[model samples]
Target: MMTVNEVSRLTGVSIRALHYYDQIGLLPATGHTDSGYRLYDDTALEHLQQILLFRELEFSLKDIQRILSNSAFDREKALKQQIELLKLKRQHIEDLIALAEKTQTTGGTIMDFTAFDTQKIKDYAAQAKQQWGATPEYKEFEQKTALKTEKEVSAMGGQLMEIIAAFGKMQSMDPAAPAVQAQVKKLQDFISEHYYTCSKTILGQLGQLYTAGGAFTQNINAAGGPGTAEFASKAIEVYCRTAK
Candidate 1:
């Protein structure tokens, strides 16, 4: 058994933090000494180690508690997830450094908009492997998509413009109407097919981009007029909820 102070000294975590953890029921006292001092057994020590590891990974205490209390918690899985997350963070920092160096040499001519692209090609490869195995399915899909000519890309863009035009025509209609919702689904499906994988997080972010300004918003608005993008965002949100 170890005293709270001993655990604090050993783990380099503050004693007050240990007390707060106990108060929150995240790290309850294992037992009480004869004089009523809190004591932690080996199991509690192990729990502390896990908690500290999660803290190092920048997980909120609540998130860590939920993870630690889950019956399916696996040390190996947790370590693997942490390692991936840390590697991503390191890569993000490196990208930022590279972008800064580019800015220094380009005399502000070359933009660092590439940094805003949070999605990495390696992540797509990993997802492909996990979903379709180590086969050539992903490669085939990539080849087919790449074979698309300028005309094909323009045709897809035309389809999006048509959707935007319809949205503009329905500007005065109820935002919850089935017609608008249908357009939203069509847009999402189009994105999933032509763009990267369309997760809810990514979709929501892209929807925001339509009205968030910058070249993307400018292009969308120029096609269908102002408020086109905002309406699309609302309609897309509704579609996402129903589709899910």
Candidate 2:
């Protein structure tokens, strides 16, 4: 485990920014020591690596969180896309360097500004973001959310958490019990009605995401108390299997 200061030095990110990232739920520390110092495990470091790469690509923090939180997110695929985008950025820099060298040789005679065009890099980065971030459900979510006032959206999110919190009350029951399954169904229907179509497949994926131990899990557990997310996931798994 590495301390926050250690991470700040290693990543060249300021301690203030690291705290801000933690505050926003963008990159939570793995744990805290008895003395209240933040500690990060290898998994947290890996997550930080992804965040830094997205930052290098000039992705907004909100966009980065949305992309990483996506249940459909594939780490390997995103890494590959980031690699391509970085290569393009490197090529763009090299082109600019060559242009500068040529202009220097010609004593500033070259008036061509084509080498400064970054449209290609911008286009590729935009395409990559769309590929990884704009899943079908996300698109649908965007459409639905675009019509709502901020207050309305916030209310909807609270309502959804209320539903998940209800699961905490039944944590002691068998996850496959009819009551638990019914609750899972209710949660699924709530998502379908408000956000996007929550088909069994999608619901199953969401179940996994809820317990995958990040912001979703954190928020869910916060609403329902500890282990609530895991219980809900198991109940969802059973519901999906029985529906199948």
lDDT (tens digit, per residue) of candidate 2 on 57-126? 9987756876887876788999998999899889889988998899888886788888888899899888
Please list the residue runs of candidate 2 whose C-alpha ends up more than 4 Å from where it truly belongs after superposition: 144-201, 211-229, 238-244
Off by over 4 Å in 1: 101-110, 116-244
How close to the true structure is residue 161 of candidate 2, measured as C-alpha lDDT? 73
The per-residue C-alpha lDDT of model 1 at residue 142 equals 51
For candidate 1, the 10 contiguous residues with the lowest summed lDDT are 128-137
TM-score for each predicted model, relative to the true structure: 0.41, 0.73
lDDT of 1 at 133: 26
Q: What TM-score does candidate 1 reach?
A: 0.41
